[model samples]
Target: MQPIPAKLAALAQQENLHFLLAVESGSRAWGFASPDSDYDVRALYIRPSAHYLAIDEGKDTFEFIEDEWFDVGAWDIRKALRLLRKSNAVLLEWLRSPVVYAADSAFVRDLNTLAPQYAQAAPLLHHYRGIARNALGAMDLHGEIRLKKWFYVLRPLLAARWAVQRGGIPPMTLAELMADLPPAAVAEIRDLVALKSGQAENYRHRLSASLIALTKTLAAEVAALTAPAPPAPATAPLDALFRTTLQRVYPC
Candidate 1:
């Protein structure tokens, strides 16, 4: 198999994209990958200037699956910036992911500087709360759940808690989120992670009473949160960045 970076480079060439950034955007990046976890690679790319000016612009996103082990997706730069303006948590997490496979340093740095300005309390809290609630809803009546679902629920709940307490974009990894958790809870989560690392994706485990209780408690705390949706940030900066990036990447 080709190395991931080489594969990504080839993909960019095929699509005629300037791949600006690529990173592990799923379990591996979140620090909870099982032995068989697929590399969920995501990227941001820029098209030639003419693509944006065309009356009928094509798809702004790309996706490909390479066997069962590599799942790749990318968003065009304009689409990414548009989503970023709305405080898209997924995009924010991608930028913060520690397992970057490739990057244009200037682009990443500029985007990172601009991202925090657009990240507001209400949307981020809402995003994480929804994910946690949905994951919790997947549990059976007896609290039998996939081993992976535990991390699914816990990570988002912790991230929601972090947004409320920390007032900025939360760290992408579970280990970082665990810092605010109680020692007992943290220890339990560590054991769970260890178990998950050896298990397959569909492995099932009965949710422990303590974990169930913690889940409920965190859910309530998150549910109780109320923040006014702040007004959107000015788009002038994003507009300028987009123009500058286009000029830089596709200059005549």
Candidate 2:
């Protein structure tokens, strides 16, 4: 393991937590990372079985933030599975992120297999739209805008569009979403992406008509579409997996 991920794993081990899955989650994982972007490490962990027997359930999250190189946190597996059932877009992104640091292939495989079955368009659409809208709020129509906000907004909008069109989980990286954009917009995006790679996070670029227009158009389309009411998933399978994993990790 690389130094950063090794540190994350060792930290978990010290805490007596079993790391079920760990991967990059933010701009670094999204493929448009600036030279100084934070390495946002996210993971799902399983606690020792004895910890679950206590009357008070302990906190289910761990967070550590230092420099841009190592901003790390994790969700307990139980919390992660609950969020997954709700089709939480952030958790879904964690599962789909291309930069995995540590994972049990079987555990990752089971969750990936179940993701499509439980994922619904409504929650994901609402989640991504909120992200895009927030990003747009940070942008200026006629003045200098943070170059990073474009990716922050456009990436989620593109994911929402893909979910609306295809009714599935969108890919985690911005580059994957770029394939669906118009050629002119794509060109502009490419230039911005290149700039982001070389420049610092505070770097600002002049707002352009084409990028703004594209963002508005996609936002409108996403707002118009209705999320399909997906059927409730059978929880028995998830329950079994949860119990099985807990036992596997902390067996007698």
| Candidate 1, pairs of clashing residues | none
RMSD of each: 1.2, 1.6
Worst lDDT run of 10 residues, candidate 2, spans 1-10
lDDT tens digits, residue span 1-252, model 1: 789999998988998998889999889999888998999999999999888887897789999898899988999998999999998999999988999989988889899999988988788999999999898887762656788877898899888888878878999999999897899988988988999999999988887788788888998999898777878578998998889888998997
Compared with the true structure, model 1 gives a TM-score of: 0.96
Q: Cα miss at 24, model 1 (Å)?
A: 0.7
Residues 40-72 of candidate 2 have per-residue lDDT tens digits of: 889999988887789999899988776657877
Show where candidate 1 strays beyond 4 Å: none
Q: Kindly report which residue stretches of model 2 are placed more than 4 angstroms away from their true locations once superposed.
A: none
Residue 188's lDDT within candidate 1 is 88
The alpha-carbon root-mean-square deviation between model 1 and the true structure, to one decimal in Å, is 1.2
List TM-score per model, in order.
0.96, 0.95
Model 2, TM vs. native: 0.95
Which is the leading candidate under TM-score? 1
